[model samples]
Target: MRNYFIDLLTKEAESNNKIMLMVGDLGFSVVENFKEKYPKQFINAGVAEQNMTGMAAGLASEKFHVFTYSIANFNTFRCSEQIRNDIDYHNYNVTVVSVGGGLSYGALGYSHHAIQDYALMRSFPNMTIYAPGTRSEITNCMKQIFKSKSPAYLRLGKTLPKNFKKLYKPNHCAPGKWTKILECKNPDSRKCILTTGAVIDDAVQMQKKEEFSNYHIYSLPIWGMQYKTLQAKQINKWDEIVTLEDHLEDGGFGSYILECNSNIKTAGETKIKLKSLNKNVCNTVGDQDNLKEHFKFAH
Candidate 1:
């Protein structure tokens, strides 16, 4: 995805000439290609994320297509106020490309995790949230953002699974009410597993262990599907609508489901069980799976 995103940006920057690439001092070798190709357009804003976001907004106000780049939390979480007040509030044409969306830096602990970006960004009025399932989808997402009139947010994974390329299309038809369901080996199963990101593969793995009766995995991009209708359907057909993701329980995809259902009352929660990777900063870690296991997100 990094290779694809960088190359895409480079080509666009060359053609547009008015685009600016601003970073919060995080992109090292990953963004070197862009920095080299368009030296004048690329600016390393050091570690001041808030200031970086503000500067991006100022640049956008000049009719420049401001492109802000950084790792998950540092780019989105740190400068949220700037993003809200300067960009979303003003409806500026700023494109924020967030890498390591979920747990790409799982070994780096909580400081690096971008668990709540989707929920936070979705609440802003003039923001368009996009989460692609593959590299091709990412390219489509870029083109999709270009057609929008408001601010844009693109959530991405640094290390994506192979299944995404074969099973997904990188395009933004819309954010909410946009869902794509892939057919599993079995079609009659009433079980519809709702999941996103690489963790969807985990649900598929669970299915191979024991063919879950009427169980089907649905890859729902961020803010995808109508939660009210989905809730009603899940209650009637399937006994479980498991939500799995590499994010915190609160302020993540699970909360998005809760936000949509205004009248749902299931013991202070929605029907979807909020399955998320723990958000606590850890002192011990080996890999992404180790972190999920230590946090008890294993299948």
Candidate 2:
């Protein structure tokens, strides 16, 4: 996904001279091609995410569509003040791209976990939050946001799926503003697996013929999904919901539903019981698969 963004952003910059990129001393080999190609547009601002964001806003205020890149916390949390004040506050045309969104750097421990990024970033008005599940979703999402003037947050996972080239239909959200239900089946069981990010994989598996054969699946990858509409959709579809995410419950997928901000969450809080499986930090060592299984995203 990082490679995909670098490629897409480079392409966008070539065609639209208004686009600019700033990095916080990260991206290593992933952003080399982009940096080499557009040296002027690409600024390696060292580890100062706050300064980088201010620079992005300065460029955006001048009508250049700017983007600030870094690890999730650096991009979204470390420089959040700049994001809120300079971009989101005035509705600047800036895109905040953060990698290692969940536990992408799991072996590196909790400091690398972007568990609270969503909560921190979403607090600002006019900010749109997106978590793309597939490689295709990443590029397509960038395309949509570049054309949009609203400030946006693009939450990308650290690793790409094995089938990186395959196109998975974006769960109705498709680079849109808020969450959308991707797929649903097995209505008789009345249980819904509500997921975001790559947990879509687990949710799909759960609804498989034998695993959770009787339950339904719903993907709300985008944050701030309007609750009223989501509620109406759920009422027309399933009964109960269990939020599945790779981040903490407070400010990620589960919290969105738990606070009644989600249509599904509201219904669950008011009518049906709500459950969540989330993590506040990297709870284990090994690869991504191990973490997923440990958290019950897979079994």
Candidate 3:
């Protein structure tokens, strides 16, 4: 996923010099290709996340679409004030690229944990959250990011799926719209496992379990507070929705879905179940799979 992001960004930069990438001291080997190919459009902002975000806003004020890249917690929580005031407040074209989201960097401990990132990023009124589930969804999200002229948060995972190129379908993705990934044998099944971000892999795994075998699988890659009404409408079509995410339940993707239909009038008859990471795993240290198992994240 990291390699794909750099490859896609590098290609986009070729046609638009206004598209720039500013990174902290991290992303060394993963970002070298983009840095070497687009020297003029790249900046190494050292370890200061706040300053990097401010600089991104300044460049965005000049009509440039700048992306601030770094580890999930550093680029987000560490520089949240800058992101909220400098970029989001002014509606700058800055995309906060957070790699190693969730427990991807769990071995480094809580300092690297990004399970609470969505809670912070989604609170920004002008910000759009792009949590692509597949390589194809990543491409679709990049298109929407370039089309919009506002702040965005691009959450990326550390690893790619096995045989991903051949396994994923090349599908189109739209904001607030569910992209159907897998269909159950029952054509009229209204029950589905809906998810966003890399946790879509977990949804697939759950489908193989007895509890979710009859559910269709769907992924919503692009969404934000502004899409509530759209989400309610989509929610109305389903009889049951099981939302999954790697983040905590509070202010996470599942919570967002509930908020969309909170109003009695907007709240349909659909049964919505939220499956998110247990808070107990926040401070634990382990590899991605082990940390996830500590809380039974996929269950």
Candidate 4:
């Protein structure tokens, strides 16, 4: 996913001189091609994430679409104040690019875990969350981000999921709009698993199980606080909806869906189920797969 982001950004930068990438002393091997080709468009902000965000905001003020890149938490939680005050508050054209979303960096311990990122990012009214579950989704997400010209967050995973298939033509992503992946064989089936971010692979695997064999698979890669009305309308279409995410229940994708339907009168009939990582996973750390197995996607 990181490779796709850099490659897409590189291609976009060829003609768009206003597009810039700033790193917090990270992305050494992954970002070299962009830096080597467009030296003026890249900035190494050292270890200071706050300064990096502020500088990116300043650049955006001058009509540049700046992307601040770093590991999940460092580019987010560590400098959240700056993100809120400098970029989000002002609606700057700065996209906070975070790699290793969810537990991709579980081996490094809790400090690197990005389980609560959605919680923090969604709190900002102007922020749009872009979490691509597959490589193809990344391209469409970049297109929307460039068009938005406002505060955005690009959450990426360290690697692709096993047995992942590429899409020939991905549709443009929009907040609260779902992109269908696998259709259920049963024509009568109205149940589906909706997911965001890297946990999408888990949703696909879950659908194959006998208990959920008739469920369709869909992903909402772009969403934010402003799309509640749109989400509520979509939720009412299905009889049963299962939301999956690697983050904890509170302030995560599932919680966001529930919040969207809470005030809707017609959405009460739809059953909303949540499958998210157990808080217990925060206590144990080995690697990404091991931690996922320990939690077993707590219901």
The residue-by-residue lDDT of candidate 2 on 87-140, one tens digit each, is: 888999898988887777666666677777777866877887777776656655
Q: Write the per-residue lDDT of candidate 4 for residues 1-299, one digit (tens) a residue.
A: 89889999999999999999999999978999999999999999999998999999999999999999999799999999999999999999999999999999999989988999999999999999999987778888998997888999999987766656733235666777988867777968889899899776687678778888888888888999877678877888899999999888899999998998786887678899998888987887878887887777622
Q: lDDT of model 1 at residue 248?
A: 70
> Which segments of candidate 3 are over 4 A away from where they belong?
163-170, 264-268
Cα lDDT, model 3, residue 66:
99
**Candidate number that wins on TM-score, 1 or 3:** 3
Estimate the TM-score of every prediction.
0.82, 0.83, 0.96, 0.96
* Tens-place lDDT digits, model 1, residues 45-156: 9989889899989998898888888887887888899988999999999988888877677777667777777777877877876676555556666776766656888777
- Candidate 2 residue-wise lDDT at 218: 56
Ordered list by lDDT, greatest first: 3, 4, 1, 2
Q: After superposition, how far is residue 6 of candidate 2 from its true place, in Å?
A: 1.6
Give lDDT per model, in order: 0.69, 0.68, 0.88, 0.88
Report the lDDT tens digits of candidate 3 across residue range 22-132: 999888788899889899999999999989989999999999999999997999999999999999999999999999988889999888888999999999999999998
59 Cα displacement, candidate 4 (Å): 0.9
Model 2 misplaced regions, further than 4 Å: 162-191, 208-211, 225-236, 260-286, 297-299
* Candidate 3, pairs of clashing residues: none
lDDT accuracy of residue 118 in candidate 4: 96
Question: Alpha-carbon error at 244 in model 1, in Å?
Answer: 2.2
